[model samples]
Target: MVPASSEATPRKRTTYTDEFKRTTVARLHSGEQSATDLAIELGIRRNMLYKWSDKIEKQAPDKELRAPGRPATDELSEIEKLRRELAKTQEELAILKKFDAYLTRLKK
Candidate 1:
């Protein structure tokens, strides 16, 4: 059995404000410094900074919507709706072609 003194203590979790996250992400996007170096300077984890950057990009209004992390349920439903509409349109087009071929046969 291990001694009680040998057990490691857990580190506390830190929360950053939205403004801090936005400015940090913007600085990273500017390419003035590497993420590793910036994270060290800011005293935050590199992976955390990357997550903030991704979140900021996803929130931009003019940017194309991307699937960040798992897609939301609403987005999944919209994609399903589009798929159904495309399938129905393709079926209708095929029927119209067959009808046109039948009409041509009658004319000949």
Candidate 2:
């Protein structure tokens, strides 16, 4: 049995301000540094930067979502959305290439 005195204390959660988030997202979009480099500089996880960027980009031009409290219509995360898009694009490209090959064969 572990003694109560030996239990580890919980770590504090870190929070960033909206201004800081905007600046970070801007820097990310500027192409001056990679996400890894920026994250390392700011002492945050690389994926955290992506999360911030996604949320910021989806906000209204006035800097707020239409319904802040409502759940997202699409449940997928930003990364998953991009992943699905990439997969669909690749599938279309492959089909086109195959169709082109068939057309070339018929022309022969």
The TM-score leader among the candidates is: 1
Give candidate 2's whole-model lDDT. 0.81
Report, for every candidate in turn, its global Cα lDDT versus the true structure.
0.81, 0.81
TM-score of 1: 0.54
Candidate 2, after superposition: displacement of residue 2 in Å? 5.8
Give me the runs in candidate 1 sitting further than 4 Å from their true place: 62-108
Q: Name the Cα RMSD for model 1.
A: 5.3
**Residue 12 Cα positional deviation in candidate 1, in Å, after optimal superposition:** 1.0
Query: Tens digit of lDDT per residue, candidate 2, span 3-106?
Result: 99999999899999999988888888777999999999999999999899778767735434323343444544776888999999999999999999999999
lDDT score, candidate 1, position 87: 100
Q: Clashing pairs in model 2?
A: none
The parts of candidate 2 lying over 4 Å away from their true place are 1-6, 60-108
RMSD of every candidate to native, in Å, equals: 5.3, 9.9
TM-scores of all predicted structures: 0.54, 0.51
